[model samples]
Target: MKAGFVIEEHVVVYCDGCGDHYSEKDNESICFHSIAQAIAYFSAHSATVGWVYDGDRILCDGCIATLHCLQYGHTYPDTWQTTVWPLGKLTRSRSCAECGIPEIEAQS
Candidate 1:
């Protein structure tokens, strides 16, 4: 007779900016369970005011906000024009089926 222990393991993807790890079960849009997904998402969109996952890490919300502040002197929260205007005058380069939707709201 033999006794053995079985341990279940979960893989987590880490956000590059904050080093925060997220699992597949986590419903947060900012994090992804796979690095390939993160890379695909980041490379697909323009880094105007949203999250970007570099090859190594997902530059999380806080970091993106910081980048905006550093580059433009203020954070444009969920501003469509700021993000859209630069994409060759509101043109999406590729099909946006896999792209995550930006949280849209009026900027006060």
Candidate 2:
């Protein structure tokens, strides 16, 4: 009896500034049953986390939550902003189903 569907998600994070991407290259990308679990993972590793939508990129649930927190005056730990530029903003635009991050309109 299959009551629910099993979703296999592969989340990837890319640093828009440096073009560095993180994924399952060596099993580093974590797996979760729900978006909450994914958000927890990012909260734990927010230090090196980034939020952006390049091309055909599916943001992990955590990325969206982190961005939302930042936009809503949520302060991050010192380590989270360690490498961040003195006056650099997190990202230009993005969107999330769970969070209220603004969505970027597609250009014609």
Best-performing candidate as measured by TM-score: 1
lDDT score, residue 61, model 2? 43
- lDDT for each candidate structure: 0.50, 0.48
Off by over 4 Å in 1: 1-6, 23-50, 75-108
Steric clash pairs (candidate 1): 16-58
lDDT of 2 by residue, 1-108 (tens): 546887556544444444445454473754466655555655666556444343434354456566667677543222221223346534233444445445433322
Per-residue alpha-carbon lDDT of candidate 1 for residues 1-108, written as tens digits (9 for 90 to 100) = 546986544345556767754333456535455656656756786365355665555675666666655665643333243335533444322221222334343322
Could you tell me the TM-score of candidate 1? 0.37
Show the lowest summed lDDT stretch of 10 residues, model 2.
76-85
TM-scores for the candidates = 0.37, 0.24
**Best-fitting candidate, scored by lDDT:** 1
TM-score between model 2 and native: 0.24
